[model samples]
Target chain A: MIENLKEIKKDELLSEVKKYADAKARFVTAVCNDLGDKLEVTYYFNASPGMEMSALRIAVGKDEEVPSLTGIYLTAVLIENEMKETFGLKVKDIAIDFGGHMFLAQDSPVLPMLKEKKEAAGEKGGE
Target chain B: MAPRTIAPFGPQHPVLPEPIQLKITYEDEKVVDVLPAIGYGHRGIEKACELNEYPKNIYLCERICGICSCIHGITYCEVVERLWPVEIPPRAKFLRTIWSEMSRTHSHLLWLGLLADAFGFESMFMQFWRIREKVLDLLEMTAGQRVTQSISVIGGVRRDLNGEQKKKCIEVLKEVRKESEALIGVLANDYTVKARTVGKGVLSKDQAIALGCAGPTLRASGVCEDCRMQKYQAYGDLEFEPIVETAGDSYARAVVRARETLQAIDLQLEALGKLPAGDINVSVKGNPPANEAIFRSEQPRGEVFYYAKGNGTRNLERLRVRTPTYANIPSLLVMLPGCELADVPIIALSIDPCISCTER
Candidate 1:
């Protein structure tokens, strides 16, 4: 488990990200996982001058829009576009908004991460 | 204001080995902005990992990128092993370290060859790959394949090195280190290579860390950071300093990698000498429990991060991978601007951007 995981409300994300960015923490990628009714978004950072991994997680409802971290951590632009495209998380005011098509072609499955697909147990059909 | 000419750099280009495009907006010869366009080669590997049982995910993870496949396999096994909190035999850790270093050795040479090729030094490119072939031979002799060895299992490595193979590996590596010095010398001393790379694509120390760059890209900027320092897997036993160069330019990046190629060779030789006598793997029982764990390891490019959550079932509830290239891409926004268009390809290649690893 993430030892330094700090659970924060969705509203506190930008400020929390601001605090890490203020400390000049290296902004690692953000992970968004499909929870039944909501998406769990986790931002990972390695504290500056050290390798301690710290994470801030916020739970978001499906339709809720999260503020972009690109304002503070410019690296967020790509991963945010990814979260938007795959999980369909609405991130408002991105610096370089790909408009949910960063890694997806038009007519591709929309929000592949948002779907509740079943694991193919004891079967490897996609080879 | 000069009228901007926006050119799409690539979904397919001469410099980039894989499919990733950068929308380069140039004001005459100098670049003003670079917006990236990717996703041409996305295979939904993470989505596939979630579909398979925890044990089956190893194969899928190993294929994430052909060049860095061994490290991918090691990282996957390490992350899942952390879930079970499995204790691998000491011999296995050394074996993994040896193989991991072998991967780093070949990968750096391949990048060096590509970097030479990017600068239009065709003969140097051929020379670098010729040395890389030796490393590939060593990997194939030990693991049964050249690129994606698939030697790593959940608890430990699937194969072990007998005595004859160990002696042969040491002899071949020492010769590799000796031969590499001549080619690497050219990178350090060549005027044309230096003119093209020395002051180009400069990412400052602060920008490198703040932008989340990794591997040689991060180290070359003088951050004193490497995932190996965290000592996951067998790296704890392997004592070495992370290579650092302060210029933060493409040449500095090249020097860092050029030196690291030698370092990787030294590391493999050390691990081979320290090979312990014991069983290679421990039997892992039961499925992964309800656990969420994060693992970070140094690949040839930089550090790779993996997050896995098990639902107490055979399959993982969620699997996330954040590759080094993905983290380093945004730094291109910083590097490309203010560089002459002629220098773009070398600057892009300096990051050693593995788009297959990035897009996956």
Candidate 2:
């Protein structure tokens, strides 16, 4: 439900994100507010252009990652792992037991995303 | 203590439509561990979007999913429009809404037919698909293309719904409504369907929400998380509620989708009746600003997320699409364990795994 997206300065956003000490609550509040929800403003982070920017995603309601609710947001681990794989951003402590090599195959299709970006830049003569 | 036997389910199976191999470690019939090996159909569509212009990318996006092509194209157009911020005409919005619901009806019917086939109910499958033919005929009549309509554009839709076409759509919807009601009666009251689907592959409300499940899958699990509730296009003006079922099992999912098909038919009729007379396409001016926007739309299977990054150019810098089947895959994996081998097809079909959409 990302109704509105506001791009803020990286440093200021990181400082805002630090305000919410609890990682789970902080993540939820940041996502909710980013999607134009009237939730209590907690924390914000300025993600890097290609890396952090791609990892930036918001999931509302029960999908938010909190240890209290374990199995409900199971796909959040995959989403977070996908972010880590594609953009090199870490999601702190997530993932129950890595599905191992089987899950590794999911990352295979994603390599092209990062590779193509570099290849396109090279084609443009290091633009 | 016994060593676990590892067995590969399939990269290709006679039953499964998509090529997904599951490396299942089994202690006899019980699956101790499952390793899903995907990436057989990855086509780099998102990367290709960077090479194509915004308008042409709509066609490319439509190709992402044959069943939900209109939604994909609409989503791509909306993402580009978000960067530009142009107002779509009410007439166009209404027409788009109608088309969207029509697509939904056909998709649900198609899935229902497949589910019936999975359950080994060939007669039911044939009947459901025979009913679905009416929907396909309606689509062909209106869009002039059955699968990839390419009817949607950036500012608005490509074609206008004329008076005669509107009448035809209404008539077709009326026929579909009658046929679908009969089909629904068979699905609901029929003993064979209930015996096969009920109490199978149950994902509770908490599990559904936690897994980021969307569309009928989440709805069946009692989570009222329909993207249409956000009122995109003419959905804001329309009156409908998200179909919900408390069971959270395969039966519930089937019921949710079946009910949704009926609701879609009703919505299409309402849209056609309230078809406004106005311009179809709005002229977009200048290059899109360097900004990013996330566009979420309710596809036939579930929610489709499209992230578009514009850099004041005809070509989009980045485009990321997250299909519902990808989200639902985790739930499928969890449900697969502890189920009998005979029930595998039904459980898989319950989520309506559209691998092409997911792999794209």
Candidate 3:
């Protein structure tokens, strides 16, 4: 229960993130947690140059896809691809999609970090 | 249109001895686009952290990056301490600050050595590393280990610095400063060194911030943002400013690191002079309370972000680490596309890519 963590809908991620970008707040990184029923993806930003920081917490359904922030911040490509590769969470239209091959090897277990790990997602996901 | 060819740069290369392959599209000599493939060294440390008890994770986190291990361990402990709402003694905070600065000094020297090696300056590389050995000796003398000190613990640091060790450390640091200045002067005045790095891999201030560059990479681009500005640990007790360079090129990055190596020494001297006297460690018991926390600490390369959610049990529900190298990779990707193919190594090395930390 950290203070200054704003709860927002998944659809608002882009617009809300744009506000941070407009405010010139640095795009820190996005963290995703598997909360059993849904994923709680939080976007963290340093609201001020010093210590003041804030996070936007959004709950996405287990199978839902979150829009990519790369459209607003080009650096989102790496972390977004990581969220796709490691968590097996869906991030659409990543500016530079590694086709989910950015990190994991071909023979590696799929979504090994996800709580409900799966091995068949990539063979099913578009290559 | 000139024909474009895509070439694989490395999971292994002479310049970068790490496992990061940059599949670069090149048109003649200039890079068209780059796609970096990592995880060759990924060990899934976050998942491992979840399996371990909260208190035992101090060592596990320290192994995230061998070069800057102390800060990772310290950051993890600090974040967990926040969860516990516990206050360590004043002396522990001071010890942590001294060790953290020492880690920074050694890590920056290591990076400068690597950068020197990238430019084929073998003698300079050895010289930089030779001075780095003194800083490492200070760590070994105080904490029992050179690279991965593992001094940080959940409640406080595991070791204390005696008066003899502190006095000797100060003397050694002064010598280290003198030796480093001789080489840093060469780096500043060497024409061949400047030609290779002066205008190479420039990331402007706005591009740097939008791309989310951290540490010297961001500061080199003229952004004055350092997590130490947050005044965590004993940092508030010291008076210093983050070193910034405006060119945002490879040379500026190198200069920032070289200057920071000196600044870190000054910081250690200040911390040692103002050493607070108190208990080093307080006994910590029980598991972290069931709550979430977000912690940020400035490491050698950049900022490290840690998110921990405790379940009131021994094991954490989630422990996510966003390392500096991981953040810097995106900026690397952006920096590579427009540069010459031959400049890739020094340009990429400018960000001080740490594959182990990035993958973890």
List where candidate 3 sits over 4 angstroms from the true fold: A118-127
Residue B22 lDDT (model 1) = 90
Best by lDDT, which number?
Answer: 1
Q: Alpha-carbon error at A34 in model 2, in Å?
A: 20
Q: Which regions of candidate 2 are displaced past 4 Å?
A: A1-73, A80-110, A115-127, B1-3
1 against 3, candidate with superior lDDT: 1
Return the TM-score for each candidate structure.
Answer: 0.97, 0.82, 0.96
Query: lDDT rank, highest first?
Result: 1, 3, 2
The regions of model 1 sitting more than 4 angstroms off are A115-127
In order, what DockQ does each candidate have? Answer: 0.66, 0.17, 0.66
lDDT at B75 for candidate 3? 97
Identify the superior model by TM-score, candidate 2 or candidate 3. Answer: 3
Interface RMSD of each: 1.0, 9.6, 1.5
Residue A91 lDDT (model 1): 90
Model 3 residue B306 lDDT? 91
Candidate 1: tens digits of C-alpha lDDT, residues B1-360: 889999998878888889889999999899999988888888889988988987788899999999989989889889888887899999999998899999999999999999888888899999999999999999999999998999999989999999999999999999999989888998789999999999999999899988988888988898888888888656778768889999999999999999999999998988888888998999998997899889998899998999988888888888899999999999999999999999988998899999999888
Docking class of 2: incorrect
Query: Which lDDT tens digits does candidate 2 get at residues B30-123?
Result: 6666666665776768779978888889889999989889989999888888897878999889878888898999899988888878767788
